[model samples]
Target: MSTEVAAEVVVAPPANDAEEGTKQSHKLERKWAFWFDTTKPKQGAAWGSTLKKAYTFDTVEEFWCLYDQIFKPSKLTGNADFHLFKAGVEPKWEDPECANGGKWTVSGSRKTNLDGMWLETLMALIGEQFDEADDICGVVVSARQRGDKLSLWTRNATNEAVQMSIGRKWKEIIDVTDKISYSFHDDAKKDKSSRGRYSV
Candidate 1:
């Protein structure tokens, strides 16, 4: 995942900042990286530099540190993306790990369950809630001017069994009311059925 740039940006944990009686904690299976992509013309330079280290945490404390520092989806301008992936995997569509995989995309207005779904999906990914985590590459969220989108990428789109299970687990994790569609890179490229060969 060539963390050269990622290594430099660090998000530190909060101090004993929690109220004495109300502390909460979480543990994740693997360490993950949080990336903020700003795709605006004016924020180019600043965004580039701002791609600074967010934080890496296996425990809940560090995750909170990074999450707390970032702007919520509602506050982000259109064209911004937030990516969370297991350490060592870059969040690029072309990565060897992601070349064949496609994302199960969920789209909706913010007034819907967009934010809740995004957060739960992230929690599922980082918390290892999927049986096919071995095939999962990472997750990306786009806050577009049109609508917000969240995607979960797998290692290979051709693995129908794994792909279908992953898709089902994703939908289950987010527990959304609307239909969620799974698309393979190949199918998506052809502009055809983003439908999964199988559904979870």
Candidate 2:
């Protein structure tokens, strides 16, 4: 039920007017699913068990509309997470698209532009701004105490060329010169990612 319209952005405060229907609507490359998890998860429970699929939006207007209402990461007083992944790709390591995947994590101070960087990352993702767009699985923004983390998930872990290209492109999109590191899910399972990480 998703529309495949060429992406054109014209974001503004959501208006409740009939004229809104007559205005041109901007479309994203594909639908994206917004997910969230609470700070206090049940002990010894399944991963992603608390995740709530807030909404799946395909249009720019829909994205802004939902973002205005429920996408409030800054309001969190405790640890939480906000995930924006491509439609159908749940933000998990076991999904078929993510089984052999990895993530490029950029850790920064909470005092920095966490929200701004996160928004930019979402825009770049839905806008298909990366050369290896298909390689992207999704993005996760973790609101932590020490520092906030922005991790761009990828579909392939062994492809160094592809992973490096994505890492560089993502850093460029976020306008950051600092090096970011990529860690594969498989390596993390073995608790050896510290030595296996690839930096760009």
Candidate 3:
């Protein structure tokens, strides 16, 4: 039996004009699923059971609603991770859409304000700001004891041109001066110490 819960699909209500004549809702370019995972899991529990679908949202208002309800990366202690991916794509590397993909990762110390960075990354993803938007799969933030990590996952590892474009745009969006590295999912799974295929 699987413990994974189905993602909840939320449709943004039709925009309505207020007394001031302004539209009330802003729709996103795509629907996104928010996933949460904690450091602790049941002994002998399947990995999927430990990773749960938290919510799915397609509007700016809904995104804020869900974000407000979830724990911020800074508040998540130990090995916790937050993943925001396209509605149909699971965050795991094995997912068909992500199997051949890679990620561009940026790390910051505990003192860094990761919550803001994560939020900005999400906005960029939903806004389709990347030139290689089609190559994007999602974004993830991992909270660790030593330092935190922010990564943008893309759909093709072999497509260097697409992957690099996404990476460069991501760096610009996040406004980070630090160099970020890109690594294939397969390479990461094989050896954590392996060097990234590209960096910016």
Q: How many residue pairs clash in each candidate?
A: 2, 0, 0
lDDT of 2 by residue, 1-200 (tens): 00111011123334543466777777788899887775466899888787766677788878877666656556444477878999999998878999999999987544667777788898898889999999998998887777778899999889999999999888988878888899889888787553437898
Stretches of model 3 off by over 4 angstroms after superposition: 1-23, 42-46
Q: List the residue pairs that clash in candidate 3.
A: none
- List residue ranges in candidate 1 displaced over 4 A: 1-27, 41-53, 187-200
Top candidate on TM-score is 2
Models 1 onward score TM values of 0.75, 0.85, 0.84
State the lDDT of candidate 3 residue by residue for 1-200, as single tens digits.
11222232223322344435765767898898888776467899766567877777788877876666553677676787889999999998889999999899998654676877888888888888787787889988888877789888888899988887887887887789888889999997888654799998
CA lDDT of every candidate = 0.69, 0.77, 0.78
Q: Model 2: C-alpha RMSD to truth?
A: 6.6
Candidate 2 global TM-score: 0.85
Candidate 1 lDDT, tens digit per residue, 1-200?
12343344453345443556577556677888777776443544532443433565677776756566562455456777777878877776556877777877877555676667767877787777888888998887778887888888888877778887788778778886666667777776586666655444
Number of the predicted model whose lDDT against the real structure is largest:
3
Tell me, what's the RMSD of every candidate? 5.7, 6.6, 4.6
